[model samples]
Target: MQQTAYLPLALALAGMLLSGPVLAHSEQHAAQHSAAIVKEQKPWGIAGEPGQVSRTIEIGMSDQMRFSPDQLEVMQGETIRFVHRNQGKLLHEFVLGTQADLDAHAALMAKFPGMQHDEPYMAHVAPGQSGEIIWTFNRAGEFDFACLIAGHYQAGMVGRIRVLTN
Candidate 1:
């Protein structure tokens, strides 16, 4: 009779232990997602407001590790909606940053393959899906975008953006 009574309590303890990591992961993801929504200014630009978007650009990602129309031109101070379509069978991401920043990030990604990050200037797209990043090119200079998913960046999945002075 005592063993039967403890059975339910033991199962509850096991459930709690098993759920601890899952809950922590969920909380971490929520925090990251929330932080991403906060608009922050970068040397390249700030997170764009939908109402201020000047135009939309569609870019394609494929298993070949290339972005279609990889070279892009944008006028400084223009807000653009970047639509990333993943036509590949694997997950991909579009991250905009300076070349130095990208190189450092790619190295980190290679070291920690399971690292999860969410930023206003990045979009993670799943296979056959799409993602978007609205950004304002407030600075005039050259910039870069790439898939910093471990081996993806090494495979030449990169693009260039020239923010021309207006």
Candidate 2:
């Protein structure tokens, strides 16, 4: 009977202890959710509206760390619908950013192999599957796209995009 009395207290204590991590996870999730709702303008450009897409470009990703038609050219203010088809056996992602930004992100990905991120300029594709990113090239400059999946970036799974001024 006395032992049964302690069960409730022990359960409460356990619940309190576990709540810390649960709260942390909830906070992290909330932050990520809020970030998704707020679109920040990047140096490359802003996210494109699906209805405003000017053209569509299909890109292929393979296990060999290569992107078919790796070089791309776009005119400023053009909204592009980037369709990414992953031909490789591994999971892949297409992330558009400046070279420096991609390099930094790659380093982070190498350190945290299981990190999860989402943005308008990124598309995570599964093997034998497809994903897409609709982006507007409002800024005229050279930018980069890459698969910053752990060692994928190091293996040269990167591409170049040239946004010509209109």
Q: Model 2: runs farther than 4 Å from truth?
A: 1-37
Cα deviation at 126, candidate 2, in Å, is 0.4
| Model 2: per-residue Cα lDDT at residue 114 | 63
Runs in model 1 lying further than 4 Å from the true structure:
1-29
Candidate that scores best on TM-score? 1
Top candidate by lDDT: 1
lDDT of 1 by residue, 1-166 (tens): 7899999999999878866665675567679796647777888899999999999999999999999989999999999999999999999999999999999889877855776778889999999999999999999999999999999999999999999996
Query: What's the count of clashing pairs in each model shown?
Result: 0, 0
Tens digits of per-residue lDDT for model 2, 1-166: 8999999999999878856655665566558656753456899999888899999999999999999989999999999999999998999999999999999889767755766677779899999999998998899999999999998899999999999987
Per-candidate TM-scores read: 0.81, 0.80
Q: Give the TM-score of candidate 2.
A: 0.80
